[model samples]
Target: MDPQHHDYTADPHLHASHPVEENKPSVWKKLGGGSLSISIIVHAILLAVGVVWIFQIIPATEQKVDFMPKGGGGGSPGVKEVSNKKQRATMTNPNTPRMAAKGVASTFTLPEPDAASSMSSVGSLSSGGLSGGLGGSGSGGGRGDGHGTGFGSGTGPGLGGGAGTMSPFGMVNPNANAMIGVFFDTKQDPKRKPTDMTPEKLRDVIKEFTNQGWNERSLENKYYKADQKLYQTRVYMPVMSANEAPKAFNCEKEVQPSRWLVIYRGDVVAPKSGKFRFVGAGDDVLAVRFNKKNIFDHGYTQGTTALYVPGKVDVLAGKKEDREVERIIRGGAMRVPVTLYKYDTTANWNNALGGVAVGPEFDVTAGSTYPIEILISEIPGGLFGAALMIQEEGATYQKASTGSPILPLFRTDGSLPDAKGKDNAPPFDSQGAVWKISPTSRRDI
Candidate 1:
């Protein structure tokens, strides 16, 4: 057999005949029978490589990377960022207390921990006092270490140096001997006589006293002799407001005309030898009658009459003419006119001022100096008559007698006296007979 064709017949069992030319082998065809061993070796290598890839290599290639940098992020870790809304809420609603039911925002503004706690308490004080209380702590505390936030170094708002301690009204004049109180008594008791009062009947005395600047009413026995020029006292009844007419005693309801002003009448004395007579000549005498109810008998009497020494004195005699005979009196009788101070909504006159007198008139000024005169005289019908001369610098005077100088001066610019005709006279306590003088109209000389 030929060497190339020898196997074809020798393996007749494996092959039926020789292959056709169209099915002949390509260039990469098997060279010999040993090629089967080479194929077996290549397949075994690929199987081993696949086992290593699945079990070991893939897990090693995948990794997790960390991106966080060095220093702690955004200040201290737990420091909370306060919103503008929260800051404003704390400032505006500082007065409100904390409650569980309220929103978290509202509770934050309230005193921390507890709302009803006292600011002065040792625990709270050490922690930080309330907003307005004394020795308070820094506002917006625990925010920063004295940094951008305004609160720092243990200080509160408006608490730096030069802050004022006293209120505006607390500043008082050192030299001024101002009236701080007043007293009044209307009961007829001889032991209660006050010397400062002019000799006159006690009738209609409350009305007469109230005509002056005594805005208080019905003083107690203890205050009848208070030594101060004018005592500081509050009235039981509400007086008229500053804007209302000063002459009217606002007893809260109506201007009760029967109310009168009162002061410590110095030492009421009985006439010594000479009989108490009218100021005028014998025939021109005046008989005075006083209503006991209207009169405060603390230092005055209903029938008491001061001896009239009519010698062109500051007080003149009431003319014995057409109507009720009257006597004139000057404000010099009582040096400084008694003054009255009003109270705010809650004031106890008896507790604060000790006592008060009712019915004295006052000067009508918003906040101006007041010059008031009180007249003490006798009325023909046995009444003790009084008239008040309340003159305001720029405003109209209330209950001023006729010919009593009305001076209109500007308080702001310190303007000089600009009086015409009747007002030409120097401003003085030139009060005249007030008897038969109506509360409103009559202004007599």
Candidate 2:
């Protein structure tokens, strides 16, 4: 028995244990044995496949993408491109007329055409032979015919005709008279009545007062003479308001608190002959005499008719009155005498007298002219004055008449003086005095 040469055929277990293995080549040995480029190519292909497989297995990251316009000019500078979906939704076929937009109607229908006979009568409408459209020109009694001129007339004076008759003409002078106001001072006596200071007494006192000389007087006589002397001497306008007496005579203090008198003398030239009305108002007494007749007299209690102060006495207490008298006169100038008297026994704040004689309704054929005089006096005076206005009867005093005075008579010093050298007379006729004129001669009818 040799140890090195053991019999293998005898042991089946030993043969099973030492089984033969096949000699497959290693990966590096096979790679080393192939051509370099071919091996490289094969390896690269394998690597590329492996990389692609690995990329597909892992999740890929997203990247941004920008789409460009077809023409390459880009979009309009300021305009934004609307989405294709919106454009398709709003688009209409060019060949077909669109009735409305997408949301308006699901289906469109065409309208039926009108029958030809419906418009066949259009040429028959016409306006008969009328002028200016609407109705004919001479329809409503107007002067014009459709083709001719209308009625046209000339202008005339007054309403319907050129002028009418029965209008007064010319104006008398307002400042024709020369007025003198003489003021006298009287003692204040509370017990004195208006009757106590009568016109007779005032006349007698005035005579004595004017006769008093400046010389030969005792101490007591000096006081009496001084007290009785005329306090003021001045010319006054014939027309005066009650309040104007003080300014006209310079006797504001003397007139209201004392006694006074005034005389106005003038010549009135009546423009024509007609009935005349003498109207007057006074606080005490008012009288008027024309053509030597006592035309008006309203003493404190002696007249049948009286105009009392509105609120003073309920039954004509005689404190104040407005009186009037009417008379007939011939044409031409004549004398007019006016007398105004006031007795301030009640110490009233208002003390004055005034009157106006609507001038005669003169006959157009008669001459025109007259005289005027006025005498105004006040006794126991608290306030006193008078005024007289003369206008034609039934004829309003015309601002344009020749006798009208344009400017006021008051001087710069508030004194009303008589007409100086030349008087500035106003035209007497106003618009109310309308006169008809002869169409031929153009003279007043």
Candidate 3:
């Protein structure tokens, strides 16, 4: 312990035996070796954890919806309807005979079948255009009975009331005038045409179809639970009954204009201050509403129903013409003697169904918006269309080939659909004349 004073030269034996223990392998070296081993072990553990964390699979987190579902909390208190809706197919203005609302001839007579030919074959060729030989439609539609799904009476182009081209888009309206169109599959609704188009029937049908509670004020219904509930601006679908709307408008699940209804309701802005009337027609039903009042109520099936409100309905109801109208509408598949009515006369149009009809004149303040509800319905199927036009007092228009003055189509905007030929051209003259809508219509979309 007290070796500081004892010199190594003085004690040679002790010094030789010990020899400073070969520098005692540095303390720093020992510490460094131990630290390096600990560092490696710690790093290895951290790396393994990192690798496991990175490579491990994590499940997708599910989103939760917290709310009560239809039919209340329990199952099956009431029946829930599940509708299979489809998207629209491609759109093209194919030649469809069903769109012959404005055919060239005011009169159409079915040609007597060539007994010698079609009886043996022809399976009722139904191609809509000129594709058939002595039958069927043209435009690439194959030979008879071979045109796909169903059979129909053999007829040719320019025949069977072949008026002119009844284009799908006969009128154009602006987005402001556009209304929300709600389509209803009324096959389950027991009520017939005119009634089915009514608000009462709509409520009943919706109540039966939906589990949701309904009230008179609500336009909402189970039918609104649709993906295709798009806005409709123009009322120029003359060939809607011709199996075109479902394809033309790209409305998927809704085929066949029959057993169906579409109600269009929205605010219409007045373009000017004047006495104006809505003029046009529908195959089955077309009812217009302004300020909760029925402005125009005319359709094919309207004649079939009892006259509930006489004065409010077709102004010419009690006359002899209505009886004829009832007969024609109730009659099966006849296209002629289509409905034509004015605010004054039913004598000119004995059969009231598909031609132009005028509503009573109403006053509107310039630029003021008014609520409007329009309904187009089909009860009995086959060949459907509706034309809506507007006319101001003393407004003269281009005369159609039928010699009727072509009125401007009722529209909010100047935009229109690219319909084919004379626009079906219609009693309203969507083609010969401009499709000018209410210029004073308020533009508050």
Candidate 4:
């Protein structure tokens, strides 16, 4: 048979019969092609696949990932890895202390305890007026005694029975042990001082605390006495939870009274003098009175009240202003703060009663009237012995009523327990004398 004629492709069955039996040779050699060249070609194809995977496929897959969560889905998995790397880099930066953000909260250092003592020493060294060392005054009422709950309560004047000795209308003595500070508006003009009080100067100062029921005659009049005075001294307005008055006279049985301070502004003749009094409308005046137990007892009840000038005055001709400041005067307490709302007709006074207004019921059947209101500020003790009101105006507006000398009311010892107890003590000395507070001094460190 010719080698070309006996073709391997044409005679599959005949070729099988003449099988080559070289089983001992390597498997690669058994094949027709050289083993080295075939192996090289296979390696080249694998290398190309690896290069595409590392350089092209991996980077392209990384760019297509979505790291952050979107539309609240299951969340992206692969993108989070790259985000974590960035966060780590930011945390390790040395130039930034924590996060280099300007809006970070700051820490404040507490003043050393010695700083307070040093300030006290400096106050003692000053030449200004000094308040003598008078013990505090205390007002106490006990509830639930041998008689019954809220029954048989006995209340004494002052904390240590000192109120009886001090006149309600009298000014607290300047040399008393208690400390007092007064700030009044007297310098309505730039070229004046508050202490430089002439008749006109005093009028200006009075108007600062109260812009109702003020007049030139009232300012100059010495005979107005305490009744005609717009703001009474040492008065508090209190509101009771219920209408039932405190039955006991003791410190505990007595509760807060529902009361308010009504102020009127404008000129009126002195109660003693029938003269026109050269009074102007729109005068500053504070109206303060106790409920039920005379104008002296500062008890109050929680109810709606209106404070306004009942009488009509010319609005353009210096119309007088009237205000109603609410306060709560509980037994054993000192001062009360009243709110003076700006005159408004559209305001809902009904909503404001319990929410904003703190005083007792004052009849205001007439609708849409302007009034001032004040809330009660609780200060322990019956009287603030060291009370001062320095008249100042123009330089500083006398927005607060407690700082006026004419007001007679003052803040008591700052630390006062809500209810009387063993810790309770008087704000002034046991003698029930007048007091003056040491002047305040400021130094920049």
Candidate 5:
């Protein structure tokens, strides 16, 4: 025992009070395993918090639903890739306003919107203005900005008055001034114009066409209707000998000159109560109807005097109308054979410039309105001319150089002299008496 004395001598007093611990795991180590234990603890705390929020707290408040569009995926929010047909914006008006019923009209074009409505409509642009009052917001509006898909900055295939705006009549000229000239496009139909048509055939065609296939009982119908022309203040186109064409009043270009027929119908007021007669002429054909009664019918053709004679219409002084009267030799009456507007009568078939025919007398009171119709036909499509002169019985007129009276020009408005005859007609005399137009006239009884 005394030889190995150092075995237990060193830490006897320290070990007596505190015992040495063993190399084993602690209780905290048993609870906290590793990083996995820490991760599990964190997830458990989060799940507990989430359960409290969903089941206990959230149930007491109003829930807001956020609906996501379904797609070809896992029922998540996404955009749908599909297509559908687009349609035009039709005209519609709200007659009965409700969630189910809205009065929809199909009229695409409207002159203007309804003023008697508090709401608006959707349609084509207006023509002029509304009949009721000013204008409301139609498809576009009355030349203003409007609401509802007038194809404003919305995304769709909606039609707005096309692109900008459209006129009512496409390409039409609704003008009003003097007489209305109804033009018949006879050249459009080959039967109306034949290949081998002569002056006689042309004359017959014109008569039949103007008569709506020649109803000899009367000469007015609604068979041949075409474009119209409203002559200026007066229709004093005395002649169209040089193939001058009538231009469109709206457009600047010349149109519809030859190979057509036109019937000028309007009211003409008598300036004075006297025995008045129509001294008219034409190259192919010229006929006048006063008060719906045929007054004169004559033309430069084979049978000039054999046309229909209606009412008091007759050959003036019972003489030939196709031949011009050689009145004098010089300036003085019954003195010299002075030529008036005719130097080479042979060039135009010895006619009075355009072929004169004095009609019968028709009594008209002053300031009275009477319907007058003048028809001029250009059948051959070559050179054409027409004129209308007036003569009052017992009224003395100054004689021309040819000793014939420089008669008054029958017209509805004022006259502007074309001395050089450049407008496809003979030079007119503005100084002569001019017949004027009247607005109101009684219909034929």
Candidate 6:
């Protein structure tokens, strides 16, 4: 081989090219790539769950509920049933009278006026005749007669007696006194007269007393007279409170648990007849009758915690209770009967503290008065208090004045006087006939 022809293959510059190999990724790097998206999704889920949990822990707002006795229907007898649509429509009209359930009608016997005397006076005035002449007294011209020819001075209709002065038929003075009776019962006796457990007996007793023309004063002394065997008498008033009254008879015994019964009788006068709503708040059992028909009946197994003290634990820590009752009341005066019963066994607290507020919204006739009454009772326990409030339709809710009594003015004869023509008369009970407590005086627990 020639020396110049040394192998060109052996030269370093003449080599063939080779392809490059890719590097494999580590496990940590692969996982790190997807971590951001996974973290974001997990955080979002956690945030949503937190929001839902917050809502669950908070309590919901309280709502009004209808309460009825076990056997009673939605409304009492004589109350015409109307659709919700019709009832709502009627409520909007101020002039329409509410259709109240018929109860035992009250009978009032008024003395007849002497017609002969009135007619004779009218005849005499007519017989006197009139002397002509526009402004004169003598035979002619100038002012002569002592009486003016232009007008006659006659007494306007006697107060509350004239055509428009009295309440419409089936209505009574709203300011009239409510007869109230308080009884203590030991439910152990099933045959007990005026049994606190029997609603029918309670109604009968109310009717009998009303028919007998018993007033608040009269009922006060006769508390134990209803049933001396089963009932222990306490206090009676046009309006009453177990908390404020002095302890009486068997009720003073602390060891012997006793049931309570309270009866209230009066008239409710609507300024303008229309739909009215009634609301009650308190502990234990309460019922209301309008026109002698049961309109509101509330029975609760758990009782009420509206006035319960915060931080004070209760073994019967049940739900808070309340009721809303609606009724159609005729304009003018309506008979109203109210009953309150508290069973010592069922009540969580020893003392009952509660109230009834009627309509923050209701239509009423202008310049009309309404009669109101309240009866409250409680067994020996903590604090006791109660009140009844009337709210004008569309008005804001305000606490009623508790310092003074809400009572009606009376004539000298112990009868409710007509609102008309009685300007100077004093109230029958200076403190007022209605029951109410000042906010400061109320005892909650």
TM-score for each of the candidates: 0.20, 0.27, 0.45, 0.18, 0.45, 0.26
Clashing pairs in 5: 234-413, 238-386, 328-337, 329-336, 329-337, 329-338, 330-336, 330-337, 330-338
Estimate the TM-score for candidate 6. 0.26
Model 3, runs deviating above 4 Å: 1-177, 188-225, 241-257, 303-354, 422-445
For model 6, the superposed segments whose C-alpha errors exceed 4 Å read 1-176, 188-257, 271-275, 293-383, 396-445
Q: Candidate 2: global Cα-lDDT?
A: 0.29
RMSD of 4: 25.5
Better of 1 and 2 by TM-score: 2
Q: Please give, for residues 93-119, the per-residue lDDT of candidate 5 as tens digits.
A: 222221221253433221222332223
For 75-155, candidate 3 gives per-residue lDDT tens digits of 131212312221011001112121123333434332222222222113211233212212223221222232221121123
TM-score of 3: 0.45
Candidate 6 C-alpha lDDT tens digits along 278-370: 433222333344444333322221111112222221211223222211121111112122222222221222233212222223344533444
**Judged by TM-score relative to the true structure, which candidate is superior, 5 or 6?**
5
Candidate 2: residue 169 lDDT (0-100): 8
Q: Give per-candidate clash totals.
A: 46, 28, 31, 79, 9, 16
The better candidate by TM-score, 2 or 3, is 3
lDDT of 2 by residue, 1-445 (tens): 8978989978789998997898999886687755776778999999999999999989864332222221111123322354565333332211122232334332433223211101111110112111011112121111111121211011111001111100010001111122222323333232221334444455444334322321122212312112211111111222223333333333344334334444332223333455554433333333343433344433231111222222423122233342322111111111123322221221121132221222222233224333233334444344343233333345444232223222221110111222223211111222221111112321110
Order by lDDT, highest first:
3, 5, 6, 2, 1, 4
Where in model 5 is the C-alpha error above 4 Å?
Answer: 1-177, 189-201, 208-225, 232-235, 238-258, 302-355, 421-434, 442-445
